[model samples]
Target: MHMVELKGVSKAFGDVDAVSNVDLTIREGEFVTLLGPSGSGKTTLLNLIAGMATPSAGRIEIRGRDVTHSSASERDLGMVFQNYALMPHMSVFENIAFPLRVRRLSRQEIERKVNDVLDLVQLPQIKDRKPRELSGGQQQRVALARCIVYNPALILLDEPLGALDKKLREYMQLEIRRVHAELGITMLNVTHDQDEALTMSDRIVLMNQGRIEQQDTPEQLYFRPKSVFAADFIGTANLVECEVSAVNGDRVRVTGAAGAFEVTEVEADVAVGDRVTSVIRPENVEVRAAGDDRESTGSDNPWIEAVVKDSLIVGGVVRHYLTIAGDVPVVAQQANSRSRLLLSHGDRVSLRWAQNDCRIIAC
Candidate 1:
C-alpha cells in the first residue's frame, strides 16, 4: 500500500513555482529522501505533504484518505526539525509527553508510552534532565522521541541533523535508520547533503528547479545516473564531452578533449557522430607511471597519458589530479598500498579505467 501519493502536485507563489506538476508515490514503511540544492522545491514539497502549505493544483492522499486541504494537525504526521525543537524549560519526560497530553491521553497511558519511546531511543536515564542540560545529540534524540511517542503513521524530517557537528551528524544518521527499522513507520527526509541522503535513504528523489531530476535506489543513482545533473550532483565525477566515434552492440567508442576512449553498457540511444558526455568516477580510474607497458595493463582498457598537477593524501586515499591532452582535467583516486607508486606533481602518468565503469549520457 502507498502511504503517501501526490498526483500532478504544484505549488506557486505569484509568478514563482516552487513545486511543479510533481507525481510521487511513497510505499508504506519506506525510507525515502528528498535531496537537492537550495531553492530546488524540496522543502516546499515537504510542506505540501505535511499540509503546512496548500498545493495550487492536484491531489495528495495519505493511506487512501484525501488530505490535500487538511490542516497540519489533521494529517497525523510526526515532524522533526533541524533546530531540535524541544521546550527548553521542560524536562525530557515532559517534552515527550506533550503530544499525548494534547490529545488528552490518560496520564497512565502517556507515562507508559513515553517510557517505551525513551527506552527505544536509548535515553531512559535522561528523563529527568532538562533540554538545556543535554548535549546536541541528546536533545535531538529527545525531539525524535517526542515525535515517535504517539506512533504517527508518517514521519517528516527536515534537515533533522543539520545543527549537529559533522561527527555527531554521522552518528545520528545511523540512529535515525535504526529507529526507522524498529518502528516501521514511513519516513520522508529532506536534505541537501548528498552523503547523508546516500547513507540514509532506501531511495533518493533528486530534485532540481521544482522538478524531480531522478528517483532511484542509492546504488543505482550513484552507479548508473540517468542524467548529467544526477551524475554531477550525487558524487564526484569526471564529466568529459565527447563525440561518438563508433558503436558496436553495447560498446561505443568516443573521442573527447582528453583523447579516444571506449565505454561499454551503453543503455542510451546513442549513435555515431552524436555528442555525448562520458562520466567516470574518480575512484574508478587507475593511475600508473607513464612508462608502463601497454600489454602490462589490459589492452582493452582505455589509457590516456596525463601529467599529474597535484596529489593529496586524504584518509589513506591518494587523490591525483591530472591534466590530460594538455588541458583536459581528470582525477584518479587510488588506495594507498605497499605496492602503489606515489605520483608526485609534474609526473607524467597513464590513467586507465575499465570501459564498463564509464557511462555515456546524451549531451
Candidate 2:
C-alpha cells in the first residue's frame, strides 16, 4: 500500500518557491529520504507532509486517506527532529509516556508501551534519568522511543543525527536502521548529507531548486545518473562534456576537452555535432601508469592519457586528480593495496573504463 502520496504538490513563500510541483509516493514500511542540498526544498516538502505548513496546491494522502487539509495532530505521525525535542524535567519514561497520556490511554497501558519502546531502543535501564542526564545518543534514542511508542502510521526524521559527533552519528545511523527494521515502520527522512541518504534510504528523492530532480535507488542515482546534477551531487563523479562527433549504433564518438573518445552507450536520437555529457565514476576508472606493462594500452584498448596533478591518501583509497585533454579534470580512485604503485604529482597515466561503465546522458 502507498503509505504517503503527494500529487502535484507545490508550496510558495511569497516570491520564493519552496517546493514546486512534485509527485511522490512512499510504500508501506519503506524508508524514503528527501535528499538534496541546502535551500532545495527538502525540509519544506517534509514540513508540508508533516502538516507544519500548508500547501499552495496539490493533494496529500496518508495510507490511502486524504490528509491535505488535516492538522498535524489529526494525522498519525511521529516526528524526530534534530534538536531531540525532549522536555528538560521529564524522565525518559515520562517523555515516552507523555504522548500516551495526552491520548488519554490507561496508565497501565502507558507503562507497558513506554517500557516496550525503551527496550526496543536498548535503553530500558535509563528510564528514570532526565533528558539532561542522558548522553546525546541516548537522548536521541529517547526521542525515537517517544515517536514509535504510539505506533503511528509513519515516522518523520529531520536530520535526527545532525547534532551528534561524527562517530556517534555513524553509530546512530545503524541504530536507527535497526529500529526501523525491527518495527517495520515506514520512515520519511530529510537530509542534505548525501552519504546519510545513500546509506539509509530504500529510495532517494533528490530535490533541486524546489523540484524533484531525480528519484531512484541509491545505486542507480550514483551509477546511472540521468542529469549532471544527479551525477555530481551523489559522489565523486568525473563528468566529461563532449560534443558528439559520430554515432555507430549504440556507440558514439565524442570530442571533449579531453580529446576524442568512443563510448558504446549513447542516448537515442543523438545526432552528430550535438553536445552531450557522459558520467564516469572515479572508482570505475582504472588508472594504469603510462609505462605499466601489467595493463597494455594498445590501439584496440580503451585508454586516455592524463597527467596527474595531485594525489593523496584518504583512508583506504588513493585519490588522484588528473588533467586530461587541455586541462579537463578527472578523478581516479584506487584501493590502497600494499603492492599497488602509488603515483606522485606530474606522473603520466592512462585512465580506462569499460564501455558500459560510461553513462551517456543526452542532457
Candidate 3:
C-alpha cells in the first residue's frame, strides 16, 4: 500500500514554479530519496509533504488521509532537518522526551519511549549529557532518536547528516539504513549528495528545474537513464556525441569519435540518422590487449586504440584515463585484484566494449 501520494503537486514562489506537476507515491515501507542540486525543487517537494508549505496546486494524501491543507503539527509525521535542532539547554534524554511530552503522554510512558529510542540509536550511555557535550555524530543520532521516539508513520529527513565529517557521514549512512530497515516506516529523504542517495534509497527521484526528470531504482537510474541530465546527475558517465545509423534487429548503429561502430542498445524512442548522446559508464569500459582481434570481440563490440594518459588508485579501485586516437579522453574503472596490469602514461592500449553497453539518450 502506498502510505503517501502526491497528486499533480505544484508550488510557486512569485512567478517561479518550484515544484511543477509532480506526482509520486511512497509505499508503506519504502525509502525514497529526492535527489538534486540546490534549487532543483527537492526541498520544496519535501516541505509540501511535511505541510510546512502549502502547494499552489495539487493534493497530498498521507495514509489515505488528505493532508494538503493540514498544518505541520497535524500531519503526524516526524521531520529531521539539516540542523540538529536540539535545545542547547536540554540533556539527550530531555530532547528525546520533548516530542512525547508535547503530545501529553504519561510520565512513565515518555520515559520508556525515550529509553527505547536511545538504545535503538546506540546512544543509551549519553542520555544524561547535554547536546554540547556530545560529538557531532552522537548529536545527529540524538536528533534522529527524538524524531522516531513517537513512532510516526512517516519520516522526512532533510540532509540530517550534512554537518558531520566525511567519515562520520559515511558511518551515519549505514546507521540510517539500519534504522529504516528496522522500523519499516515510509521515509522520504531530501539530499544533494549523489552517493548518499545511492547508498540509502530504494528509489531515487531525480529533479531538475522544478520538475521530475526521472524516478527509478538506483540500478535503473544509473544504467538506463532516460535523458542526458539523468545520465550525468546520477554518477560518473562519459557522454559521447553520436549519430544513429541503421536499425538492425534489436540494436542501432551509432557513430562516434573513433569511427562508425555498431551498437544495439537504446533506452529512448529514437530513429536512424538522429543525433543522439551515448552514455557509457566508466566502469563498463574494458581495456584489452593490443593484438586482440575484432572478431574475437563480440559483434556489439566498439573497439578503439587509445593511450593511457594518467592513473589513480583510490580505495583499491584503479581509475584509468585513456586518450583515444591521441586526443579524445575517456575514462575506465577496473577492480583492484592481486594480479592487475599496470598501464602508465603513453602506454598503447585497446579500449573495447560490447555494443549493449551503450545507452542512447535524446534525439
TM-score for predicted model 2 compared with the true structure: 0.96
TM-score top scorer: 1
Question: What would the per-residue lDDT of candidate 3 be over residues 69-186, giving only the tens digit for each residue?
Answer: 9999888899988899999999999999998998999999999999998888998899999999999999999999999999999999999989999899999999999999998877
lDDT: which is higher, 1 or 2? 1
Candidate 3: residue 262 lDDT (0-100): 66
lDDT tens digits, residues 1-363, model 1?
A: 799999999999999999999999999999999999999999899999999999999999999899999999998899999998799888999999999999999999999999999999999999999999999999999999999999899999999999999999999999999999988999999999999999999999999999999999999999999999999999999988999999988889998786887889564899899999889999998777866775534536666788999988888888889988859789888887777767788899887778888999998
| Candidate scoring better on TM-score of 1 and 2 | 1
lDDT of 3: 0.88
Write down the lDDT of every candidate, Cα atoms only.
Answer: 0.92, 0.89, 0.88
By summed lDDT, the worst window of 10 consecutive residues in model 1 runs over: 294-303
Residue pairs in clash, model 3: 251-264, 300-355
Tell me the number of clashing residue pairs for each predicted model: 0, 0, 2
C-alpha RMSD of candidate 3:
1.8
| CA RMSD per model (angstroms) | 1.3, 1.6, 1.8
Model 3 TM-score relative to the real fold: 0.95
Regions of model 3 farther than 4 Å from truth? 289-295, 298-302
